[model samples]
Target: MTLYLCFCLAMALFSGPGAILALAPENEVPLHPTTWLGENKVTPVHLPKGRTRRLYFTLKKRADLMSVTVSPCAVPIEWSLAVRTLKDKPPKKPHWSSKKSMPEVWWRGSAREVRIYSYTGNDVDTYTGPVYAPASIYILRLKSNEQNTKVSAYIHEGPGPSGAFPELPSDPKVHILGVGMTSVTLSWSPSSSVVVKDGHHGSLPYHEYCVLVNHKHNYQSLCAAREGIRKERQNVQKRERREKPGKEIVWATLKDWWWQQPDALEDHASSLWDNPEDPGCVCRDVESVCTVSDLLPETQYYFDVFVVDRVNGTNAAYTGTFARTHKEARQAVTSLREGQVKWVTLSGDASSQKGEQLFRFKPRGWQQNGLLTLHTCNGTSKVKVTISSKGQVLSSEEVGHQLAQIWLHGGPSYRLQIQALVQSSSSSSISKGDSNKSKFCLKMQASSAYHRRAAPVFPATLQIKSFNKLRTCNSITIAWMGTEERSLYCVYRRQIPPDAKDIRHSSTDRCLDPEARPANERVLCKYFQELNPRRAVTTAVIGGLDPGVVYVFDVYLMRRWGLPIKYHSKMVRTRNEC
Candidate 1:
């Protein structure tokens, strides 16, 4: 019986109280020599029932306290842990009740047996404040509930290599594949080596690539703008300090003021891709090639590439180079007198006695002349050309196999009609003696011309209060304040033209027929709706729009005698259809 008792005692001592079993072995342990938690020194402490103990450690550099684990002595015990960063001075003994008043507390929870607490920015339960970068002195408070407990505390550090882990690989090679007016395509070779942190190889499979773009040509302007913003912020801060003599400045107040600046610095930089499947910016085929779009034209841009290890919370040095996108090609509108050629085909069957074709031309700028070349379907047939502007004939000519070139001096609007006459033998005419009557078809092509008009007085500006996206896709609600009473307001909406030159030319056409119905359903505009002018606040819901199309809306107030006075214009793009 004594021998059996000795065996039991030996087993108890071997597997029980002083066994040195790791309570939470999976918890991350710091590996860097400089890390405060890397010392591996165990502080054994005894806490009475319902009592708390606080321990302090100072971080010399910026680091992330990833996790905390507790190894209980012999019996399972209920315990709670909390961490707070001491900014100014360490507080007196802090209890669970005073956790909220601490500068920044990370974890607060109770558990039985071994416990491991991990840190996450989104800690919705206890802390509702911004998760700041870990630095300075940290206080770890441990509490025991209804049971006396002896435990060894272990804190984990992140952002450093541990064990035989390797450092981050060298920067990747980035190359500009192509650069367009509004986009830049970049290709890069992936890092050959892995990044090591927390005594383990980085777990994140994807490396983040950041593309930084700056207008090299406008570098001076950008620097000036940045300086101006800095001065403006400084002036505002000085004014606030003067107004509130000794009041403490809060970070939230300054953050709000910084965001309110029209030219915020953050606007200049953008991420290459926010996520793996970002639609706007595409990183295609093994993620080696990234295409960044929605850039400006005729601008010189300098691009820099950065590789980031997000899981390790570290970034590689920027590998930078500069490239300029080709300037946007301007559309050249050659006038008719300058030998601009445009073709309009007028064709008819043999039974038709006459064929006519109407040509409409809207000039770019200033008054000019147009040239018309009439091509006969039959080489032997003679054709008559008649060009008119606003119901007045500008020219008349006749020619045979040789092309009929007619010079026309017309106003902005022109309509040209052509007539063809074919001489026929009596046998072919079905009348034995008729020679002048015959079946013929005519085709005429007219070149474009430039015309000038006097600029008219524009109407009073219409103040648009707000244009907001609706909950439903493909719709936007616009609200505007009216100035003149009893003014009939017409709202015109159209899709934005793809070409810049088309924008200049279409602006005139959009104004001419703001109420014209569109022939194609795909066309969003040529849309017009009249709003009641008696109301002070004018609001309208523009709907039936094609998804992902940019549209421009023009509000015109009708004057006396039905003349539309251009008022307000705005551009908006509809959301993509889900």
Candidate 2:
């Protein structure tokens, strides 16, 4: 029994990073009986930074297990907890650099809410059988990080007052109940082993499940992957510029340029669709049946069902399947000659709140750009116009009473979708059946000359101008001039390595939160802002830097869909004196 307890203690002590402790002789202190039949006392504790707090308790009567619940207050904290008995030693200060020591159970985590440590279960979301022993005294030792944290502690007896951990849940079977334009309905059977006694007093047996929906489309992923490859190749080229011959380097550069063309990249992406990788975790719900909404239209999705045990917070994977949502409208061809404008009238039906009209355009030896315009002709309603090709939406706009225009690029074939919103109207001119319906006028024209417009189109050259005068030792300002009015800019910064004397930045680095990376290359600051109409140039400041350190800052222009474009980058050094 002692050996088994020691083994479980070692397992728990070495579970997390920087968890090391040497047990000492038990220190006698005032003891309180842990609550079993009644509510456990909630003792609020305020722990100073780099300090320790201990509470001693005794089990009224030992059965199978005991649980200690530490609920945090408003502040987030990095803390570790260790429980000891009279036979075992008390927890001493942990030597975080070593992993040789052991304790009855030690847990370390950063949390802003509740954290429960079970004496019976192995701390990492599983129950490895109980290794608990009866003791006259139990000690709770807590250590905090640099933050002065506050928490409430509750010690209880038994596997849990709520319920004991059940067996691993059976895998679930998932099926598509229904699918719509922007949503997918899924249903799955309950796991046989998921029944656990969970209620106000642990008297009810209930089943719990988690339904996961993952977006299976790879269009955006393909673009991001290509961008990464392009950046890596550019880096290699820069590194080999002097070592390699001029002729070979020129030819290699030309090949790289050719591969970057849209047609070539599309073809490459198509070839990779045979065996696509699953990008997990789009949406999830704690129900057997779920309807995921606000999804992309006419896209592929994957569904998963997991049998979960609420007591121990363990999940058993069941089943998953792929499903594609219905398209917005059916396909039909519309022929338009060069320099020709065609107009069509659409009638909204009262029976349906929304209506869709789809037309396919295959240009032959025509101009690369097309113009589409829409306006409500009769009744009060709004319309949404969408243009797509190869399952990729290029442009979509919502038009009300005024005329709206959308420009399209040249392609082998394109799909046009016009969706009308039917509004209720009591006008006498409208028929009774079509009383809630409306009429819209749609005009389509093809010509290179129509490309001339007042404002610059999006995805235009995004260039970063000079920085503003807001430079300081700890922060630097980034200034950029944009051609489009409504644009989102994202900036990222990383410390330059000392070995990199002649450094060049990777333009394809993903725009992610600094907290996502480890301490080495983590971004210390983030800046995201939309373009201000009143100002001609936009500027953002990045702070939190050490003096005498060189950092590289990259600016990217975010788009509504697909990957962002890397606009520019700069290298700045902080003032050493600061």
In order, candidate lDDTs are 0.45, 0.50
Tens digit per residue, CA lDDT, model 2, 1-578: 99999997787677743433334223321134332222255455777878766655655664666665554433344434333433333345544534532222222211121223433211112222233444333445555664665555555565634333223334435678888998778776655565455467635334355444445311112223333334545675676776656545433322211111122223434543333323222222234567667656887866555444443332344456778888885445565555454565666662453356666655444554555544354335577778898889987887774435566674666788777655555532456566433455545444333434332334333555445356667877777655334556656677876787566553323323233434554333333444543344667777887777787776655433223345545777777774
Per-residue alpha-carbon lDDT of candidate 1 for residues 507-529, written as tens digits (9 for 90 to 100):
32322334453434222222223
Q: All candidates' TM-scores?
A: 0.26, 0.31
lDDT of 2: 0.50
lDDT of 1: 0.45
Best by lDDT: 2
TM-score of model 2 (CA atoms): 0.31
Best by TM-score: 2
Error of 2 at 109 (Å): 32
